[model samples]
Every structure is written in structure tokens, then in C-alpha cells.
Target: MRFLIIGGSGFLGAELARQCSTARHEVAATYLTRPGETTGVEWLPLDVRRREDVAALIAAFRPEAVINTASRSADWTTTATGAVNVALATSATGGRLVHVSSDAVFSGAAIHYDETCVPDPITPYGAAKAAAETAVNAIAPTAVIARTSLIIGDGGSPHEALVHSLATGKGRGVLFTDDMRCPVHVADLAAALLELAASEYHGIHHVAGSDAVSRYELGRLIARRDGLDPDRLPSGRRADTNAPGPIDVRLECGMTQQRLRTTLRGARQFLA
Candidate 1:
């Protein structure tokens, strides 16, 4: 199958490109900045916010599957509408589309959330992602929306941030324990996204790690894994009063496992 991954230079997108190339699938990835070369994939330039660029790329490639991994993410207006437009442009060509989203879409009230749960995002980032999901569904109901949690891998994600902070030991020793998230490895998420692209399953699906650890616990775990001192790790901040975060944002993966029939590893497993 021919595949196109937007934002292919990112942590998740890079993993997807690598996996797809390993599987011997025809893959073409797009990037805004200078993306490093991959052995078996073609990297192209694309900005999802530009509809004409999206259209032209699809027309030239004619890929059977298109995955949107691009978003403003930090800004609501750009993320919501830009993502929506990209989805519309791609799906208009009749190819399957998969929109990579976040578990932040939820307000973190429910301990366990399935695809049917309604989204009540509190932050602008969450709101934009939620709105993008809605627009994607409306444009192509058959399109798969894979909502995932904290992505760990490569160098730019939260995982790297924590590791770097600890290694440098320059910042204040304050960990936001209140900000809860399931840590999903980038390789696992990429695998799930590919599975969804190959199958006929529709609607929202979760591709996340098995364990839900607190921010403080997660720091300790990483430190432990790296042979660092967990005792030096700071205590967790208050879950409610400290900052803005999801109280309990664990995703239910029953549907994903059953549909994709793929075995997903836990956070430790990935780190190992």
C-alpha cells in the first residue's frame, strides 16, 4: 500500500515512516523544516495549513492512505481549522485518512474513557484537537481518529525534556504530579496508526501505553531506568490546585486491541 505521512519529521511521524518502510510499503513523508534522510522513504515538503499544497501532493502521489500528523497544536485557531482543512483536502481524493489526536481532548474527569465519551477540553490545545476531531469526522466519517496520550521517544517530547532537565540539574525541582497522562511510545503509536490505515475500522481509537503513572512517579521511573537517583526526584504537586492538567486521562484500549489485533507494550517495556 502507498502511504503519505504529514509532519513525517516529528517523533511520531518519524517512527511511522521507519515502520512503514521496514514493512516494505511505499511511503512518502512531508516536512516543513529540513528533515533528515530515511533509508527507504521519500521525504517531501508540505505545510498542511496550505490547502493547495495538500491537494497537489495527494494528486501527485495518489497514495491509498494519508495520515495527518501536522497541527499548530499550541494555538487553537490554527490547529482546529488548519487540521480540518488538511483532512478535507486529503479525504476529498477518496483515500483513507487517519488524524492523530491527543487524550487531552477529555477534561480528565472519567477514570476510563472509550470512543463514545464526549470531549470537554479545558485548554486551547485540547479544544483545537477536539474541534479537529469533529471536523475530521464530519468530512470523512470513515476516517480513523487515533487519540493517544503522552508520546515518548526521539528528543523533543516530554520524556526527553524530563531527562534533560534531570541531567542538567539546573531547573527548579518541581514536578507537576497533577498533570496526568498515559505515556505511549512513539513506535507503538505509529504501529497502531498503520494498522488502522490498513483496516476498515472507523471512529475514534486509542493507541496508548498500558500504565497510567503520575508525573512524579514517571520521573522516578525514568530516573530509575537511567540509573539515576530517584531520591533526588522532587515530590508531586497538587493534582487540583497546582496547575492545569487532566486528573485521570487513561484511555480504554479494548476496541483498539480487538480491532487491530496488535499487542501493545507498557511504558517500561518500551523504555527497555
Candidate 2:
């Protein structure tokens, strides 16, 4: 199968590209600016925000599937435009698409969210992502909507950023105990996305670790695993006095794990 990964330069995208290449699939991954060289895979300069760029990519690659991991949710306008461009590109080619979303789309009110759960994103980033999902679904009903949580692994991931700060004795200054999330490994997530791409399954699915632990606990685990002093770690504070971050991001793995043979390991054990 020929696969094209949007945002293939990012950590998760690179991991997925590696897996697909190892499987002997024809893979083409797009990057925003500087593209990295990957063995057995073709790297292209792609910006999903541009319609002409997307059109050219489709015309040239004619991929069987296009996985969209590109988003500007950090900036509302860019996110909206980028998501729409992705939808148009895939819809035009009548190709399969997989849109990567975040668990932030949830309001964190429910103990656990299923595919049928209504999106009630609180933050601007979350709102934009939820809107992107709706737009993609409208354009291509068969497109896969994957909602994931904080991803760990890779040297430059958010998890690694925290670790680097702690190792340098900077994280001891502050930590958010109230802000908790289930951090999934990038490698595991890549496998799940590939499985979904190969299947006829559609709609939203959660791809996160099995454990839902507090940020403080996660810090201690990472420190302990790396032979650092766990006691030096600072406890967490609320993101705001009244507004607390999400605590339980525990996702119930159904289609991703069962049918795809992709298992999201518990963060506790994985980190340990």
C-alpha cells in the first residue's frame, strides 16, 4: 500500500513512517520546512495549509491512504485552515484519511469517553481540534478520527522536556499535581494508526496509555527510573485557582487494541 503521512517530520509521524517502511509499503511523508531523510521512505516538503501543495501531492503520489497529523491548534485560525485543506485534499482524491486528534476535545467531566461522547472542549486548542474532526467527518465519513492523549518517548517529546528540566534541576521549582494525563508512547501510537488505516473502521477512537496518573506521580516515576532523586521533584499546582486541568484521561481501548493488535501499555509499568 502507498501511504502519505502529513506532519511526517514530527515524532509520531516519523515513528509511523519507520514502521510502514519496515513493512515494505511505499511511504511518503511530508514536512513543513526542513525534511529529514528516512531510509526506505520518500520525504517531501508539504504544507497542508496550502490547497495547491496538497493537490500537487495527491497528483504526484496518488496514495492509497493519507494520514493527517498536521494541525495548528495552538493557533485557532491556522488550525481551522489547515484542517480544511486536509479534508479538501483527501476528498478530492477520494482517498482514505486518518485525522489525529487529542483527548483535550473532552470536557473531562466523564469518567471515560467513548466514540459516542459529545465533544465539549474547554480550551481554544481543544475546540479547534474538535471542529477539525467535525469538518473531516463531514467531508469524508469514512475517515478515521483518532483522539489521543499526551505522548511520551522520543528525546524531544513533552515527557522528555519535563525530564530534561528535572535533570537540569529546573523542574524542582514547580509541578502541577492537579494536571494529570495518560501519556502514550509514540511507537505504540504509530502502530495503532497503521492498523486503523488498514481497517474499514470509521469514527472516533481513543489511543492512549492504560494508566491515568497525576503529573507529580509521573514525574517521580520518570526521575526514579532515570536514577534521579524523586524527593527533589516539586508537586503540582492547579493551572488556575478555579480552573483545574484534566485528571482522568483513561481511554477504553476497543477497536484500536482488539482489532489492530496494537496494545497501549500502562504508563506506570512502561515508565518503570
Candidate 3:
């Protein structure tokens, strides 16, 4: 199957490209800033905010499956509107589209969320992700919205990097104990996503890890795995530090477990 991975240079996107390429699938990936070479994956420059560019790329590449991994963590225009533009463009192609979503879509008031749960975002990032999910569903119902949590792996992830920095006193920050996430392994999430892209699964799917852990705990786990001093990672409550942020956004993956052949291990389990 032919695959298109938007923002393929990113952590999760890069993993997806590598896995797909290893599986011997025709792969085309997009990059915005960081450029790197991955064998068997064609990298292209694309700004998802530009509809014409998206259309043009799809027209030329003509992939059977399109995965939108492009995201702007802080920018509203690029995060929300950019995703909508991708949905509209992908809708035109009639190809299978998998919009990589975030567990941040939830307000974190609830402990567990399934596909049927309503999105009640509390933060700007959460709001953007929720908006993108709505737009993608409305514009392209055939598209699969894979809502995942903190992507982590042994290879220096953002979370891992932060842990390592704090462990060595290179970075100074408080790890939040109140904030909770699933924290799926990049390899596991990417493998499951690739399967979904090839299949005809529609609507939102919780494609995350098996364990739910606090941000602070996740950091400690990474530190422990990498042989760093977890004591160096100072822990703080999100409610105490800043305004009460999303406390817990744990995704229920019963459907995903039964549906996909791929197995998503827990962050702690995978790290070990």
C-alpha cells in the first residue's frame, strides 16, 4: 500500500515512516523544518496550512493512505485550521486518511475516555485538538482519528530529553504530578497506526499504551530506564504550579486491542 506521512520528520511521524518502509510499503513523507534521510521513505516539503500545496502533493503522490501527523503545539492557525485544511484536501482524494489526534482533546476531568466520550477541552492546545477532531470527522467521515497520549521511547524523546537534562542539572523544571497521560511507546503506536491506515476503520480510535501514569512518574521511569538519578527530577503538582490543567486523560483501548493485531505495551513495560 502507498502511504503519505505528513510531518514525517517528527518523533511519532519518523517512527511511522520507518515502520512502514520496513514493511515494504510505498512511503512518502513530509517535513517542515528538520530534514533527515530515512531509507525507503521519500521526504517532501509541505505546509499543511496551505490547501493548494496539500492538494498538489496528493494529486502528484496519489497515495492510497494519507496520515496527517503535522501539528503546531502552540499555533492555533497551524494546529486547528491546518488540520481542517488537511481533512478537506484528503476528503477530495477519497483515499484512506488517518488524522493523528491527541488525548489532550479531553478536559481530563474524567479518568477514562472511549471514542464515544464527548470532548471537553480545557486548554488552548486541547481546544485546538478537539476542534481538529470535529472538523476532520465532519469533513471526512471515512478518516480515522487516532487519539494517542504522550509518545515515548528509549531513543531520546522530548520527555526523555527533559528527564535526562534535569537529571544532569542541564534543565530546571518541575514535573507535574497532577497531569496524567497514557504515554504510549513510539514503536507500538506507530505499528498499530500503520495497520489502521491499511484497514477501513472509521471515526475516532484510542491508539495509546496500556498504562496511565502521572507526568512526574513518567519522567522518573525514563530516568530510571536511562540510568539517570530520578531524584534530580523535582516533582510538583500542576494545580499548585499553574492554573488547574487537565488532570487525567486516560484513553480506553479495548476496541483497539480487539481490532488490531499489533500490541501496544505500557510505557513502563516497554521501557524495561
Winning candidate number (lDDT): 3
Q: TM-score for all predictions? A: 0.92, 0.92, 0.97
Root-mean-square deviation per candidate: 1.9, 2.0, 1.2
Give the winner by TM-score.
Answer: 3
Expressed as tens digits, the lDDT of each residue in 1-272 for candidate 2 is 89999888887888888899999999999998788567898999887777788888877788889888877647775566677787788878888888899888877778577667778887888889889988988988999988888887735587767865875687644566766687888888888999899889898888888888777887777777777787877675765545534555556665566666878887797788
Q: List the residue pairs that clash in candidate 3.
A: none
How far off is residue 81 in model 1, in Å?
A: 2.0
User: Residue-wise lDDT of candidate 3 within 1-272, one digit each (tens)?
Assistant: 99999889998889989998898999999998765478999989988888889888988898899888878878887889888888877778777899999988888777899988999988898899999999999999988999999999775589888888888999988888878888899988898888899887889899998989898999888888888888889888877766645887899999877899998888879877
lDDT of 1 by residue, 139-200 (tens): 98999999988887645576657765764585565666765677877777888899999999
**lDDT for residue 17 in candidate 1, whole number 0-100:** 90
Ranked candidates (TM-score, high to low): 3, 1, 2
Q: Candidate 2's error at 103, in angstroms?
A: 0.6
Instruction: Give the per-residue Cα lDDT of candidate 3 at 121.
Output: 86
C-alpha root-mean-square deviation, candidate 1 = 1.9
